[model samples]
Target: MEKEYTIRELTKLCHETAQEKGFWDEKRNIGEALMLIVTELAEAMEAHRIQDQANFKEELADTFIRLFDLCGGLEIDIQEEIDKKAQRNKQRPYKHGKIC
Candidate 1:
């Protein structure tokens, strides 16, 4: 069977896996989500400074995976949000970029 899964579907799988593995509980998973993202991002930045290939790739994947899990647990529509954010960013100019 030629099967395909949407981002939402795949994200839900991550959530399920997390629940089964005790990575999350009955409530929201935002705590774990933020930890996974921020920590990995910091680690990735350090890895980039020293050019650590394995840790960089691992951090990148881990950050993305946590984002997926967060979306699944929070029922966030990421694709539509990304599209909206893209349009918003387009409307902003380099002036704001410098100010911010």
Candidate 2:
């Protein structure tokens, strides 16, 4: 069986890999990092548009990796934030009071 990693673990792993690859050799530009993640999502959208299942899945993974790396670099506790947001969302009305 494969080992399961929590979101925090994945964050650490992704950040460590990025650092090892010299992504952190110098101070990073937050805007550029964010845009790169957006680029990955765009790639995923293109893959989905063409029904390229394999590439679509890979691009989705890339998105998460980039997000995790960002969270780790900033020392943000993503799991805790997710839990807090989810709890708050649970108290909201259907669709957060939105139509359509």
Candidate 3:
């Protein structure tokens, strides 16, 4: 069977791993952390462009790992925020009033 974890659990796990690896030994630069996540996504995009399915999937996972780590480090309730944003998005019109 596959392992299952909630968003909160994953956040904790990711953050703990990062801490164990000494990534959190110092106060993190939030901007740099966020950029690292963006870089992961950019890598995923490049992987997709080149049809590297394995790398694309790995990069996508890296993106989420970085994001979850950030949220964990900052004590942000990312799951709650996502739920709230999803609820708000559900109330929006198609295309969110944009043309094109």
In the range 30-49, model 1's lDDT, one tens digit per residue, is: 67668868998998899999
Model 3 stretches with alpha carbons more than 4 Å out: none
lDDT of 2 at 67: 98
Native-referenced Cα lDDT, model 3: 0.96
How displaced is residue 43 in candidate 1, in Å? Answer: 1.6
- Runs in model 1 with CA error above 4 Å? 1-6, 26-32, 95-100
- Extract clashing residue pairs from model 2: none
* lDDT: worst 10-residue window of model 2: 22-31
Clashes of each: 0, 0, 0
In model 1, the clashing pairs are none
What TM-score would candidate 3 get against the native? 0.96
Q: Can you tell me which runs of candidate 2 are displaced by over 4 Å?
A: none
Which candidate's TM-score is highest? 2
Best by lDDT: 2
TM-scores for every predicted model: 0.72, 0.97, 0.96
TM-score for candidate 1: 0.72
Candidate 2, residue 89: lDDT: 99
